[model samples]
Target chain A: MSGNSEMSPRRPRLAVWKLASCDGCQLTLLDCEDELLAVAGAVDIAYFREATSAAVDGPYDLSLVEGSITTAADARRIREVRAATTTLVTIGACATAGGVQALRNLGDIDDFKKAVYARPEFISTLATSTPIRDHVPVDFELRGCPISKRQLLETLSAFLARRTPNVPTESVCLECKRRGNVCVLVAHGTPCLGPVTQAGCGAICPAFHRGCYGCFGPQDTVNAPPLLTELQQLGLSPPQLERLLRTFNAEAPAFRAAAESLGAGGEK
Target chain B: MTERTIAVDYLARVEGEGALRARLDGDRVEEVELRIFEPPRFFEALLRGRSFEEAPDLTARICGICPVAYQMSASHAMESALGMHVTGTLRELRRLLYCGEWIESHSLHIYLLHAPDFLGFPDAVRMAKEFPEVVARGLSLKRAGNHLMEVLGGREIHPVNVRVGGFYRAPEREELEALRPELEKALGLAAETVRFASGLEFPDVEEDYEFVSLVHPDEYPMNEGLIRSSRGLEIPAARYEEEFEELQVPHSNALHSVRRGGGSYLVGPMARYALNRTRLLPKTRALANDVGLEPVVTNPARSIIVRSLEVHYACEEALRILSTYRRPEAAFVPPPATFEGGSGAAATEAPRGLLYHRYELSRERLIERARIVAPTSQNQKRIEDDLRHLLERQIRADDATLTDACERAIRHHDPCISCATHFLTLEVDRR
Candidate 1:
């Protein structure tokens, strides 16, 4: 590792930038506590404002940007961030697809801001929050509300090694079955989003004896029709299933159709 | 004569987006700022139409590090407005889960994040290379806290079991009893953390500011207490807005809070430590005195030591609760969300500091309006004050000295930016 970092000719400075989402995706980096020392030894963090006061000049080799571009200014900020980096990888559902805050995209942004701030006029934000790809060309996207730490480290390692990261794009239901956990829908009649949601977070909810809530965004090429049918089978009226899909990963295509099928917008 | 700006564009090992900046004009320091530029999600606006029951889950997203505190505060407010007492094992279970949060969040901050700053390192990962044993010990302690939450709340991040009135489910006695060994191991690690923090190089900067935290007569405040400040101001949680008020500044979208009289007061570890020193677990109390941590004086800079002391207390508290943990006869009390008219506020001790929630529930059981004053928000003004004070110390020092001082200043408050990210532009004009 020392020889690799030294003989790599030039250390690619990495900058972590945030947009609009839960801080969880960025937190995954720190959450990799055990592997952090090893990871730092490999990469030269040129501009990670979340972690250090010191800055090394950055025309970064790689930029791992978290969150979605939500405001008009953030829409501008992404271009500046993209210009300074060679490879731009978006991490988390927020950056790849619009995050939970995208729920505001379906509603009124001015009405939303006014409800929260005493002086809503002071806030400068866009009517919609969209993924970084809408604003700039993204090299890669590691999906999930808070991207898994192991997956993050693996992505970093792959980027450094000049190889594609070994990330699975299968549905969480596949992993849930691989772990030999019983299907809650088959046995307990509990509706689950696992069949359509991405395979990450280790199928956390199912392991905890609850159905998946799809916090990790949707899986690749998801079959949403069957799941909506399952929700109906489990006694969820159309409105209930609509509310369920419109949570954290609301704006993803598969979830959007499921919500629309039930005849509703992204509100309770 | 030279004028220079010391800027830390990012702070490492801590949660959320934070940067520290200061300007030195020759031998005089012009301005200092602690800025939170984390991306904004506008949660307050989103919650306007969400169901009252959804508040716990929705607001929990505010901080991944301290979701439990948000859930607790929101739940209590909702329950109170619904005119109900969440009595029996459910109440005890809530306390136990809070203890888990205290253990996890405290250990994570005190050892992994804040300790390295005192020891002259770039981050915890750097510090860990020299202190492997300490890092390992801290992880297991942290793991124990997450484990406790997993068992009780369903998952560590945005736990599922908690609801407005009670949990959806409860763990059996055998499952609850299984955590004893983990708690035991955590206690050992906590003791080591005390020694480790005690060994760090603490700068000789102390302040005589006011310490504000929740205090309960029966215990070191966890779920409920009378809001108290070191300046001798005490009031019920219902009167929290009256005492501590948030002001919106034109420079930033985030609100800066202060005690009603005008002076900024601190929250989190130092505040909690001073206000509830006597109520600390026995072993933790002894360790505080052992480490030479005197609860006297409100030095925001020295709060790191106090944070370490509180970690000791949290570990001890976790162990106590785990050992005596009894599954209450009932997991939770039923909700009375149909109250005609009720207004209530709730305050809970988060891993960082006091988290306050106020709600006005209408007869229909939907929320008319809600106000959430997070611990990180209350501590913002205090953090800026620390920056201003620390800059005075490094007035004669170089850019590097001022930069480190700015780091130290922000570290004093241990700002969590996900909650405060809606606002900030820290400018230190040297001219």
Candidate 2:
């Protein structure tokens, strides 16, 4: 963990950046109430607008980027962010995948603008919301609609120590089993994406007696086709199955293809 | 003639991406635009065709700070549309959940976001160096709220437990009972917060705000109420569109909301406190009176006191609900097996202010159309008005001091820019 200490006498500078997002992922850092001051002691919180008004100019030692790139300006701005950091970690579904806003990717952008705004011309937006990895090379991707607080701290700790983060890429079903939660899919015959979704959220939905809605996006090796077939048999129609796959991580390659196979992707 | 411009390219200490620009010509403030460049995510546009059941979770993505507000508004709107009224233990649980959000969101603003402006510090971290106990108290208070949310809603941000009719699962009696001790501590912390906020030196400034909020006859509004404004405008949520309109301005991604005939109005802590002062819990009301906070807080900078008082009420309210909570028989009230298309609208008091949601559902229960009027969006125009008025008074101050003051004034309302586009560079020009 002390691998990078010899390189600089000063504590590492950490910068938190936002693109197009709900600010939830960045908030995950603040949500670490107990660990926040300790983390601050370990590093200089040079730039984090949501928590502080302070900004220290880069080249920062580590940068945690939240949200997706949804505008041309953001696309350009993200490049600058990448250039300013030695290690760049994308946090949450928005930064790792395209988030819920990526729903625009499968619909008509013009129609979307018109639907939400009376004067569409006044809005400056890209047709699609794409993740940070699409725009810049990311050192790590922490996935969740709002990234898990535990994983966020671990990621920060790992980066400070100059080590690889220990985030697993396993499906949420594994977590559910470890949690001793009854399989909602098998027991209650409820449709769930746990079998195909990532594990970071601790299988919270299933534990809550609700079916997983795949807020964490896809797992490492998703066999979504079989899962979709099972869900369809469980009474989810083709469109329902498509809508299920096309949520927070709609633009993720695997989920996008799954939605498209169900005849639900591209401009609506 | 000398020309000067004050501009803040990227605003800090507020949620989301935003900037401020105010242009002043000589002694007169020419233009003050609360430019909400937080790229429009098209939440309303994207919601179309999704199942009505998905509204709460989906709309909760609008702002991370106040997801509960969105969830409550969306769920209530959907429940209204489906003709399903959730009452009894379920209703109490929802209110309890909202109290958690209020406590969490308010504590965040009071400590991390707004406190720095008053202390002349860049951030809370710096403030914590000198006043560790103050910062610790705030964090502890915030944790109590987040813990309460985790027990009920599953996680703090974008909780998985909320559904249309009610929660996905009802928390056990023991689960709720466990939160009481923490909440008991939080109540004292909240009172301390109110006192601390009241002690801050506020700029001697006031605005003639047309305060608006949800007003329940029996209690301080959080979930259900008729929409009432300080200017004698009272209407049900169904008539929201008839009275107010969201107009598209050339400079902003967020549409500015205004009363149909009137111009800008305020909705938030000040608004809620102004319209529902009598409805607050006795302790919270007493705390306000003890602090010498006026019944109607027109000074936006003094909103900290109002927000802190609400936090006190929320903690008390949570403890009250926890004491009386009985686990509902069912996790959620099931929607009808068959559906007939209908439209419904509802407004809920978010920690920020009143959040309004309207949805038109198709026969199949798919959301045909959706409209969301976030509190910040409703307050955007009024915020600009505040800035304009502020610039008029501080026009003689230098660009740097004036800009700093402008940013502080904006922070007073604690605008969630992320929710507003749904929502600051300050430029002062002297010629």
Candidate 2 scores a C-alpha RMSD against the true structure in Å of: 1.5
lDDT of 1 by residue, A109-156 (tens): 887777767677877777877888888999988987667777898899
lDDT per residue (tens digit) for residues B228-310 in model 1: 88878888888888887887754455677888877777788778887888898889888878877776646665666676676
Please report how far candidate 2 places residue A260 from its true position, in Å.
2.1
Best candidate, TM-score: 2
What's candidate 2's DockQ score?
0.82
Best-matching candidate per lDDT:
2
For residues A1-268, write the lDDT of model 2, one tens digit per residue. 2346548668898999988899888888888899989999999888988888778899888899998899999999999999998899999999988899998987889999999988898889999899998889999999999999999999988887777999999999999999999999999999999999989999999999999999988888999899988998998888888878888998889888888887644342
True C-alpha contacts between chains kept, each model in order = 0.47, 0.84
Candidate 2 displacement at residue B328 in angstroms: 1.2
